[model samples]
Target chain A: MSTPTETDAFEVDDSSIERMRFYGRLFLGACIVATLVGIVALIALVFDVVVEAWGWLTWEFLTHPPSYLAEHYDPSNYGDLPTGPGGIYPAIVGSIYLIAMTAVFTLVLGVGAAIYLEEYARDTKLTSFIEANIANLAGVPSIVYGLLGLALFVRAMGAGSSLLAGALTLTLLILPIVIVQTQEALRAVPDSMRQASYGTGATKWQTIRNVVLPEAIPGIMTGIILSLSRAIGETAPIIMVGAATSMFAPPNLTDPTGSFAAMPMQIFEWAKAPEDDFQHIAAAGIIVLLTVLLLMNAVAIYIRNKYDR
Target chain B: MTANGPQTVTTSESDGATSDDAMTDDAPLGSPRVDDAVIESRDLDVYYGDDQALHGINMDIPERKVTALIGPSGCGKSTFLRSINRMNDLIDIARVEGDLYFHGKNVYDEDVDPVALRRKIGMVFQKPNPFPKSIFDNVAYGLRVQGKDDGDVEEKVRTALERAALLDEVEDQLDSSGLDLSGGQQQRLCIARAIAPDPEVILMDEPASALDPVATSKIEDLVEELAEEYTVVIVTHNMQQAARISDKTAVFLTGGHLVEFDDTNKIFENPESDRVEDYITGKFG
Candidate 1:
């Protein structure tokens, strides 16, 4: 195709544009390859876990509390011999309670902080410093958060070996994710929408409540789902907060101050018990955890698509 | 004719003696032959940070009349229009120095409430910005914002739509999203929204610039009809639009000077300023 004479005034030579197109395609290919690599690893891991654990997953296995099969508690010999398997009911209940409590605290705290930062805070030096610290805090290791929970919630708060401490630990570990995503959600709302509201004589809070909040809700919800998934999967923080691997005497689900066992801790204990049946139960537990993560991600994607319209 | 039996300007020779009025200049522009001037500015200056936008603007906008401000790009025409209703207050760096008197009250006074003031003086922006709501809701926004839930909301919305010439087109689909309407229809919906609150002064900032030729003509006619009720001030780059619809025209030239303010016929037919004549004649590069 030939270019029009009139277009010559505005259009640049095609060579540079062609070069940019080539680079764009190259970059797109590279990104797809990276994504496929991650996907392949995930698929292989899930397949292996499913094949190994499918037979062990049963109503009975899920309903009964796990117990040791060996005659004695020999740490060295346990790994070499076969151990009988029980259920993961207590661990599942404990995780659900922990995650539920974490969501309640983290959602309220994160969304409120995000709103203040995005809407009310002025672009001053102190605000920038606080923002920089929050970004840095998000990158800190989950283990550090575990230590913090142990120091603050477990010991100082006098909630020894309790679900409350584990919940608080998970909440802290995921709070930064929630805040960052919520802030981005609020920021994605165009300034024009706010201006239109103001032009109609609406006050600052009125505009935010009426226009900005409605538009930002879906994004904030997506953030919550993603953060909660991560919280549910955390093990170190729960362990540091005094979550027990073997809750010999299981506590009630609502017992915030009693000892708890999460899926990770239960699975970790079972897989190390030398019994083939315990290893099968561990694989089954992994499959259940992965399914929960997948479901949460799906829900997040659904919310994002609904809001994008 | 002005409402109070005298326009902001006076008869050529006799009333020129009145030197107390700050806006009254020595060079006679013309007698504002109308009844009353609803809004008047005296030595009004506008600034965006350190940059001076408009300088020494003095004019009386006659009540229920169309006064158009025309200028080249960056010549402060839009700035002047925004200043009338204190819309410039939205900009952080924008500052107004001189007095803008509306119905003998200075809006810039410390005691004046800007939100209340905005309700009385509505505005329509250049691009149509209808809310992402239903057509009925968009028209009802102005009233709803004020918590006016009187049973007559339906009647008020209908009347506003009728006045804006959008009722016939959108009456059947009041529940449909405002964004679903055509460009021209959305703009008319905006007009209905602005007029729903029953403001006395309505400012249009190139309200028809984004539409097609047919839509532009329709808006021009709507503007002329609007001037019969509310005081209308419009800023436009289209010279013919200013000439066709306006009662009085203020010619803002380069260097932020309003070179001429006179009857539209006089300005278009026989302008007094050399620069205004050059601009009207398309002599500028």
Candidate 2:
């Protein structure tokens, strides 16, 4: 190919410029439409759920456990509950317990693994292999993790379809995501900071603990919160790990090896029921789940903003 | 030379010669030294991976004086400076060969920890890199890292900032973030941080290259003042800077060879090598 002459290169083609501008606008329009598709669908779904749950989302509905007989339900008979169609208080409590446990387990394991990989691991084939495997694991189906948890925690450890088993399953499901995000957070800290610490005669661990970790904490916190939000919404893994669809009482917070129920599991059961009232109850349950997720995201944003510098 | 002229040392006395003596014997001759040398390198070679960055560098830096390493880009001046404190150890590909002595002890010996070596030799970089913490914390970082952060931390930090010529500007705002300062203030903050640990020597890699003219002059003044209390080795691209502030100047050429090492006046006005003269007169790098 020959290079363009100076004169030819300097000359601007108006038609071609117009055509390029038109194509750029077309691409922008396409991107806007693509974005609006997801946003509109989400808004429509949320609107439908709010409308259906408007009458059912009451203090009684929130504070009482689910009951079988809605017409005969009475506040005075609260001692003997689950006989009348009441609320999803037990499910909410169970979900919170599962998420909290999952958060602790995943945070410890994920941050530790990330620190090892990013800070200590040498650049070799073995480390690259481990890194690649972790990335791949993040993309694996949640049900596969559920099976692993079922085999390891539920059967081998004899946790017996309890809150421990469910939380462990969710932990496994989101561990890879947490690890990957934590690695990103750690890597985002500038190498200059590490050099500064080391130049001051700080040992390797001292540098990491003082300079690296402090700078990375905000990013790590955001990653943990986002991963916890994802884990809280996971239904299939919890189901596979044997979360109860309905419960009269919340799981014992101090006892890990006890029966549990989760919001998604309760919603699934309610949505599956033939009664229309149960469907409205499921919608209300969805609203509660969404609110938890929104709160988690808000916390993540707040942390990122507060400590961003 | 005047009575208080730059301390000049001659390296051509070939007595007790080793194989490395051949390289240093060819180096330019200069006046006799008055001050005791604090750091010495014998036929030091540095490599980044398989590429040699410094070739047979041999010199002794005098105590309590500013020694400037000046060269064009890619001449390994920075590499030599980093080698003194083993800051190059941070790079996995970097390798060092030959003896680098501090107080008659070879720093590259097996038992000498790089961390311990660095405690006595602090560094400042080209860019002003103050930590994302308060100004007091930034200056106190080095002391805290060395576990010297006891009751007198406030007094030591103030002295450090004062020596760095930054205390007057930031006395009331010690709790403000170091990153909030201007470029010159930040560089001084870094200098204060380095001095807070009370290191015997400070290595600076083009510390004023990124600053404006006013900031650069301020840094130049600080460097001269620092030499009163600590030995300082600096790398610079500006020949004028090497002349204006340095007591001794070592000029490395394009091939990572130390072409001339002498008193700054001699190196600038009457270099022994034609290439050095050419470089000084701006005919060629």
Give the best candidate by DockQ. 2
lDDT of 2 by residue, A1-309 (tens): 157788777555768889999999999999999999999999999999999887777677677787665432334554565455488899989999998999889888999999999999877899999999999998999988888888999999999899999988898888888899999999999998888888889999999998999999999999899989998889888888888876889999888898998999988988888877677778888999999899999999999999976
Off by over 4 Å in 2: A1-24, A70-85, B1-35
What is candidate 2's TM-score for chain A? 0.90
Q: Across residues B1-285, which tens digit of lDDT does each residue of candidate 1 receive?
A: 223111222221222222334334422244332358888776677899899897766677899999999989988889988888787887778999777788879899999877778788888989998878799988888788867747899999999999999999998999999989999999899999889879898899999999999999999999999998999999999999999999999888765656678899988988766667788988971
Interface CA RMSD of each prediction in angstroms: 1.6, 0.7
lDDT value for model 1: 0.80
Per-residue accuracy of model 2 over B119-214 as CA lDDT, tens digit each: 999999888888999999999999998999989999999999999999999999999999999999999999999999999999999999999999
For candidate 2, the per-residue lDDT at B107 reads: 98
**What lDDT is reached at residue A195 by model 2?**
85
